[model samples]
Target: MPNRYLGRRIGKYRVTRLLGTGACSWVYEAVDQDLEIPVALKILRPEFAGQEQAETRFRREAATAARLRHPNIVYVRDVGQVDGTAFVAMELHPLTLGRRLALVGSLPETECVRLGIGIAAALAVAHASRVIHRDIKPDNILLSQSGDAVVADFGLARALPSGSFPSDTNTVEGTPHYFSPEQARGRELDHRSDLYSLGATLYRAATGRLPFEGDDWYTIARAHVETPPSSPRAHAPALTPQFEALLLRLLAKDPADRVPSAVALVDALAALPSAPAHAATLPRLGSRTVEAFRPQVPGRFHRLLTAAVFGLVAVLAGWMAWGRTSSGSSAAPSPRPTSIDSTGNPTARGGAASGSGIPLASSGPPRDSTRDTTRHRPIPAPVRRVRLDLSAPDSAQLYVDNRLVAVGRWRGEVPFAPRLTVRAVVPDAPATCHTALHDTVLTRVTPGQRLVIDLPVRGCAVVRYRVEPRDARVSFLSLDGGNTLETRADSAVSFSLPTGRYLMRISAPRCITFSDTIVVRTSGNASPLPRKLFCS
Candidate 1:
């Protein structure tokens, strides 16, 4: 038909069927010929060929994930390139959370909470290693047949550096629906970003929708930065308040305000009680009595059928006894079991039930296709107001157009002013005053806004310095003795002060001698600003 990829062999595995496809890759169920085990193979698309950066990132993700060994995390078995296609082999699971959600509308509270705990535990491990899984959504979480959860997709993860690095430039590389506020604004990100994404994923899994839904990326990005998400209980009222609070903390606009770590998140989830109800009971698939399509059996076949019936009866007896002991003798009875036959009709307690009326068992996994189309109403606008204040140091007199406006320390909350210029000078330091003379200038201030300006003494200068270095061995000293700066190679440093005469010193190993002194005046603009030194 359409170039079917079934029945192909790659490496030591034979591909059986295509599991799914995404923007850049495809996954298939493949069998290992030697071990006789099933594995899921993820292959990169041809479009990514010749892209070195993409290839490097993919390899890094695989390598990092391979190092993680946690019960709630998916296991990565092998990674290799076969015929120019990069592939990752992993444990093959029955269904994903996405498929389950789609088939069953939304999961029960107990199941959602249990799944959240498992995911949070896995994220704790990833975050401990300084790895952030930028993408956390329903499609990336798989559910086992026994009701266990495992997180997948480390393809978009990256390790954070102490300071800044070239890798940080790609900060906005995640899906918009789950990106954090900092990520939405294209700013540096930390592990808190992943927590925010996890919160969004949990919100969707529990409510069957996204917290901040939009028609396009721009709207969603704006929502992430400026709008508060709806409370989780709004959609799922049965959710515990503590659980809701945890989700809100995860969705905090500022990274500093989010839960400090993934481990803490696990603790929070662990503290919550189990869900109130059991999972929806699915109809057994073998109970249906179907019409025999083959002819009557001979004497030997009859004997075989009798043996099969006895074996089935023995197995049922054991199963019932175990259930009675575990659930108490008076446990609620299960709904009469039913099953779908080849003719599409369900068979159970009576005649064949109407095919259209019977509910299908929620056997498939969750899906992410639900779209919210509601429009928001506009908000009323507000009024405006503005103010400004200016000041200068001793030996400095303010001047405007060859006339003195005020002497030292001139300050006031004045009305709207645009382009107010002042210059200062002193007889002792003529060269210093030459530059400081034009240092004081005020720009326009809008109504309802506040502006403050500080001017330095005419014959003296004060400089603000920050020592941002690649190595932490350097130390910064100011002649005034009030301010000091010290930092390691990977630390950010800052210094601030008034215009004045002072000495400065910097120290490091195997580097040029660093010491300087200068008399700075308040007359000119600050030049040759402190530089960020990168030491090898």
Candidate 2:
């Protein structure tokens, strides 16, 4: 069905434009006529609306999300059913962090830290209320105009249950790349699972890359269960050792090894010196504090004078000098030391002297020697030629400073003779593209110098299959007796198998046994397989 954005108004909100669509719902930028505010309206997909169980789950999500009133959490304004369609009204943000990250390649260290802290703070609030945000990823984080971060998509979140799964059955309800080891193995999940997802999101934000990458969903999901993540510091060496340590702790296979709560993680982050806005422009350690300097009078005089006498004299002289300099040269340097002091502030004596001197006269008359040396001078031209080569495993859409320049396929070259920003994005995984401005004066791109860029696809194939009766469970058994694969109820039985053969089996109480020997080729479609049967 073509996406219909008609006169579907939920509660007092009037649907305007279609923002986006997900598997189960369609989101619209709508106006709340009663409240006279813009809100995001999420309506259940038409097919899912008829399912009572799905509707119940949707209602529960709204209730849980509505209870969370955090600065970093997207506010849910209203929830109701209109003309048999279930919809929710929520605070609307301009864009998602995922889109921004895609546009900029990767966020600066300071921005990543700030966003991470905000997300952690929001998660802490949810955890306090016994809610677990099972789906935590870059796409779920929204960015406000002021750069504040807010967590969205609480529809998949669930209240903490009292019991744990004993068998190979669990509801896998998160993006594969960000899923925790426990979540991948169909085991019990807690706040730690969310922490793992946060770490994955932070890893991408810091490095412009995902911790685990593969051609399909199973491969990436299995990496979460079996493979160790590449160090974030390896990709972005400028990241602090403390943050690297935090990433490792969050990615620990054992849930107990991770931070106990989101609040604790936030506290730990708050304790660390905030990541600098620009790596090249980091401030000195003591740059913000005022230094206490003792007056350096002739040694015996300094010791003999009382503290009150010295302080009073220094303050009076400082005020008189400050007034004199304030009206002096417009070109004179401000009354601040060029270098930081031991206490992180400028030395009082040095700072007081900067603006005290008379402005130096220009060295001789302003030179007009250009007229005398015109014959020897070289005229500079505006245009500069720069060779640009774009190469990737597959096709890429190339952009120069946000403007689409060309679309390249396979390993090829594009000679961009003009000095401009160059960015390449795979249409599917726009987030993985590399974006950089070419300044010929600062840097030169030579011919035969290939710029190799990797365009990350979703990196995993999500094969979703529903086992009938709700109670029936599925598992992938290796005919070679290697490892048993647990399956999630809401998700397909996934495994990171290469182009090879494997045996799968399904089991449940009083159900006919099911097993199959299937050859999974790399180039085949990603759709879920038809239900298979096994002899009891």
Candidate 3:
């Protein structure tokens, strides 16, 4: 990822802040300094930009996407190299289908079907051009301010020759939730694969959940390959039989069994009754056409906060009421003593004096002769949160058990793990203190314990970074912080770091990564270690 690109120009586009990140590139909202208009720019990662296969695919994305002219497709404006990085500029939508889904976990059946038809129309145009979008997740779909759905991001599109299977095999592309069984197997794919992915997306839109839920990606991928998806109706019981039938047919493992083409899929959606009191009319991907368009995702924070406030109020009220009763009773001077007897019951001190001048029984029920001996119950220990406050050299990063949990002075409940290892490192330069820009300390901390590590620096080192292939993507991983960009092979990147032993890992795509202990000297700026890393 680029550390700083704002105010930089790639052709006519001037970079601003990041819009969002994706698997292939980092997208930024930019302004065309020439046209004085806003546009979205996607910069290819250095690793993917240099590889021959990746570059060819990137070029195909630009060319194939540019060939299309449709209302439902994101229009590509320009594509070129900018400052050693490859980028594509496209019309800015400002909103995405993913963001909409985040707000609306699910959609009404009619709304879902309408969206499906709109997307299918776009896919029909792409498939007609012999291009198959390998990645068709909801994030790739953009929404105009008017709510019209526009399919975007053709970065993974594959061009197919007439009447032939593409040579790509043993390559799996697409989101895990939408991957077809054939894709999970790394088999050749055609336009039909996009239909299956569309079905998966539709399933989520209708049910608010994926067909398969797993703890991790590997398990989900395995389920996609080995297990049949749960019936969509299982999650969305309101779905009509006709709707469920078409969805199941689209999701069939065999491509031949799916809808013949995107055109057919659109036709099927159009055939369904889109307007009726029972069927519920849903405007086809139009602007938030009606005020009834409400998000399905429920916000829990407000409700929880209200409940906690009420709970605290109730507890305080009860405690105050109890104190008032105790005070009133004390003033009245009850005959019974406040002290408890051996049986754990309140008894009178003066031979259990009572109002009638006769010894009275205990306040509660009488003890049974057959009752067992009373055993003292040890008080239960209360579970409490252990606060963490860590300290290191200024800009030092911290990690617990290989997971970067804190930086600088951080306070948090101790992580739940046996033999917690607390490590600290200071980066030669401060980017993010979440990773290992410096060395580390492996201290074993027990769960439910607090600790403060004042890590002292041994002293500073002026180290220079040199990588080959000026365009080759490289990054310095801080054991104490998150990943940050390093100086390109052309730029002589050097930093004055706190003197301490540190482990810095340098990695690039299409090349083996180099990892080792780099010790900085205790005295003044040490001689530049003549170590040059090469990507081979």
Candidate 4:
């Protein structure tokens, strides 16, 4: 598809060029006519405009960012839906932490800690607001020209009530390599979950490699839950023992074993001496007493702000030169794959299918899964456990082998069996919309694999037709291979079928056959007036 919004105006912003794309929206560099400043405008794709779930997510991201005002969080200037096109305008940055890592393999220990403190402070404020940024990765952290890191892309963020953390077991939601153990297990998450992911991101920044790697998502997710990460000093031998111990504690499998909160994380990272430390004084791994003997860590925010520009002068200068060569690329580096499901196929942006026959599109290709021959070794267990993921309507009930198992948005482990019967039921559904319950037989069981099952609930729509002849016969055929419906011996006929596009055909004994394509919608928007067909 050619770029339609390029060189055109959406509201007051004139889109100059495409910046990057995500699962459901496109980021474009647009000049705001009112403010006369260049901003990054994220707009929903045309195919997903009318979808309730997609539109809600697009708006939620804007609403979530608008609530937080911090130096390290991306600033949202405006949000609007003009002519059914929803978009958000945000401050534009020139570089991202991901792009920087790609250019320079890894940063020095001191520089890495400086950037970590800034991001931890941002997370501290966000967690105080009771908002959890479910997806925190290198791609989501943007860097300004002055080397300041700003967290962006909150499409996966959920605003929970105070002291409430819900278990999102339906699917694993973050980048595979950076998942926290609790997140990988689909357990209840709190601020500590974000802390673990930050540790993983910094692990990559310090060592130039992921803490865990595998050929597939399940392999990596299992690694996060079961395996312990190698010491950071193993990969980058130059790293100080103190820094390595901090990284290991952050990657603790149990959230309780990790840093208590973002505030504590900021303090801990700030207390690290700028140079290498002796092994005798290093904090022992998994020891909660490490904070007791540590020196009083001064407020890091002021020091980072005042000294970062000078400490990173060489980095900022190199970034400026790279920006000039790359034609001024925007900071948004194709938002992380929040919609990646267990099947390895990316779903719609909002964690559910949009109900459109057209496959929901994503802006970037799925991340490549590499085989980790060095660290991955098969573990033998007596019983085989496999995770089951089902996509059904809200309140729908799922059964396995005639026993009730779970309800909406459920992911749980079941013992491996060669063949098992699966069934789904939607209670209180209208008689016209209830789909028959059938036993779905699943085969080819494997250990440590995730299975995704989609149960479609068909709904009915009525179409009234009127032919010129009083007794003309009319028929409707579903293009999607549904059963054909017809009515005869009446001028006015009403046909009820599943909601979708259909081919309408009308015929009489003495008139030319008439054929046209019609649509059956699931809402009140379906036309009430009878369709008038002229047969000359």
TM-score of each: 0.50, 0.53, 0.52, 0.52
In order, the Cα lDDT scores of the candidates are 0.64, 0.64, 0.67, 0.73
- Model 3 Cα lDDT, one tens digit per residue, 1-536: 45234334667786654677876677887888889999988888776867887777777778877887677788899989965688889898877878888898988888788778778877877777678887887898888776667898887887778777453899877788888888878998888889998998888888888877877878888887677777888888988888888888888878899997776687577556551222123343222121122223224884586468557767997999999988876774345534445655444556443444223454667744333223334434555545566676555556554345555666677535444455565433322222233333434545577666565432244666555544444344444342333555455556545445556665566666666666555343445433344655
* Candidate 4 runs further than 4 Å off: 166-171, 275-536
How well is each residue in 1-536 modelled by candidate 2, as lDDT tens digits?
A: 21243223456875545566777888887778887888888888888978988888788778887887777888888888867778888889858988888888787677887777778878877776667888899888988877878998887787764453122347776788888888887776777789999999988988999999877988888888878888888999888888888888988888888986676676455445554333212221111110111122235653365355547757987999998877764554554433323433222344354543322233466423333222334334344334445443244454443334455533444444333444444332211111211111213555445554443211112334556545557776646434555765445444454223557666776768677786644344477665644334
Worst 10 residues of 1 by lDDT: 282-291
Off by over 4 Å in 3: 47-49, 165-167, 215-218, 275-536
| C-alpha lDDT of candidate 3 relative to the true structure | 0.67
Candidate number achieving the greatest TM-score relative to the actual structure: 2
lDDT of 4: 0.73
Highest-scoring model, lDDT: 4
Can you write out model 1's per-residue Cα lDDT over 1-536, one digit (the tens) per residue? 10123334567876555677877777887778889998888877667866898688778867877886776788888899876768888888858888888887677667777787678777777765567888888888888767778888888887766443223754578889988888888887777888898888888887777889988999999999999999888998878787788888888998888987665565456545553222111111000101021133236774596468557767997999999898864765444455545443444545444332334344565321232112222333443433435476565555442234465655444434455554543323322223334345656646656656666443434344544444534444546543454545345443333355455565565555456775444453355446454355
For model 2, give the 10-residue run with minimal summed lDDT.
285-294
Candidate 3: how large is its RMSD?
18.2
